[model samples]
Target: MSEPPVSYKRHRFPPQIIAHAVWLYFRFPLSLRLVEKLLLERGIVVSYETVRVWAHKFGPDYVRCLRRKKPSRQDIWHLDEVVVTINSEKRYLWRAVDQDGYVLDEIVQIRRDTRAAKRLLERLLCKQGCPPKRMITDKLGSYGAARRKIMPKVEHCQHKGLNNRAENSHVPIRKRERAMQGFRSWSGLQRFVETFPAVRNHVVPPHSHRSAFATHLHRLAAMAEWKSVTLTAA
Candidate 1:
C-alpha cells in the first residue's frame, strides 16, 4: 500500500520579508510593535503580531544554520555574569565567549551560585564539546568550583583584572537591553542572547582589520557560505 502524500502550506510573506524581520528583531533591541511600525514606514504592511510570530519561528533557525556552517572552535574561553532586572526581580545572565569575543553560549538563571554556574558551564561544554585550554574569569568562587567539576585538566585563571575581555563583551548586550526594556522571561532572554551573538559575528569585522565596503561584502559572503554549509550539514 502507498503512503499518503504530505502537503505544506506556504506562508503569506516571501522568504525575504521573513528573513528581514528576523534580522531586525535581533540586530536591534526593538520590540515587535516597533519593528512593525518601521516596516510600515518602509511601505511593508505587516502586523506586529505577525512580526512576533516570524521571529519566534525563524530567528533561532537562522542562527542554528549559521553556527553549523562556521567550523572554527574557540580555544580559550571567558566566562562572566551580568545582572538583569525582570519584572521587579533581579536575575543573573551567565555568559561564555571565546577569546575573539564570539559568544559561545549564555543562560539566564535566577541565582548566580555554584549550582547555577555549574549548570551553565555544563551546558556550554556540552553544546560546544571543545574544552578550552585556558578559562578566564573574575574572582568568582563559583567559577572555580564549576571549572574543577567540568574541566579538571583545563587551566582556570581567576583574577580581579584579567577577565576584561569577557567584561567588555557585555557592553553590546547592555546597550541592547536598554532599548528593549529588559527581557520578560528566562527563555526569551536565552533565545535573544544566543541569536544576537551569531548576528554580531556575521556583521562585525575582526578588530585588526580595516572596515570598508569591500570588507563588508566579504564578511557577508563568508556568512552566507557558513550558513549554507551549516544548514546542509544539519
Candidate 2:
C-alpha cells in the first residue's frame, strides 16, 4: 500500500486553517503577529509563532505548485538589480521578468558585480531552460559582461530607460520593506523574494488588457489553483 496524496497527518489544525494563515502572510505584507490577529478576528485562534512555522513549512510547497502551473514565460526578458539593506548591511536583489510582467526568477547576493550577474543569468537559464530571444536591462556594465560570458548568442539591449517593467516591479518590495521595517537576515529575505513573486503572479491580472468577464474568469482560475495547492497541510 502507498501513502495517500492528501495527508494532514499529526496536524491539530485542519488544512483550511493552516493554509489560510500561510496565505495571509505571503499574499500581503502582513507580519506573523498581524496574521494571527486577523485570524483571531475570524474566530480562529492561532499564535504568531504558529503562523511563522506554517509559513516556513508550507510557503515553499505552495510556491512549487504555483510555479508548475504558470504559463510559459515570454521570450523577451527584463532584468534589473537594486541595492537593498538587510540587517543594515547592503545587498543586491536581481530580478528577471518576462515581457508580459511574469516574474521569471529572483535572487539576492552581496555584490552587484559580474559574479552576481552571472549567478542571476545561470538561474534564468536553468529555470527557463534556454536563453531568452531578447533580454533588456539597465546600462549595467556587469550585466553586459556576464551576458557576453554566459549567453553570448542571445540579443542583449543595455539601456537604462527601457526596463520599466523590471523597475516598476520593485515598488512592491519597497512597500513590503516599509510594512516590515526591514529584513533581519539575508536567508529570510532570499526565501521571501524567491516565493513571494509566485504568489503575486498567481493573483495579479493584466487588467489593462483583460475585460471584466475575462478578469473574473482569470481570478476564478487563480483561486482554484491556490486551493488545489494549499489545501494540502504540511
Q: Which candidate is the best by TM-score?
A: 2
TM-score of 1: 0.84
Model 2 lDDT tens row, 1-234: 422234467889989998888888888988777898999999999899898788887778777766343334347889998889876689889999887787888898889899999999999888878678888999889999999999988899988789999999898878888777887788988888877888888888852577889988988888887887766423
TM-score of each: 0.84, 0.91
Worst-scoring 10-residue span by lDDT in model 2 = 65-74
Model 1 clash pairs? 68-230, 69-230
Tens digits of lDDT, candidate 1, 1-234 = 432221113787666666677777777767788889888898899998898777777766666555332324447788999998888888888888787677777788888888998998789778876777788999989999988887788898998698887888788889878777777777778777777877777666554556588787867786575445333222
Clash pairs, model 2 backbone: none
Per-candidate RMSD, Å: 5.1, 3.0
lDDT of 1 at 28: 74
Candidate 2 regions exceeding 4 Å error are 1-7, 67-74, 232-234
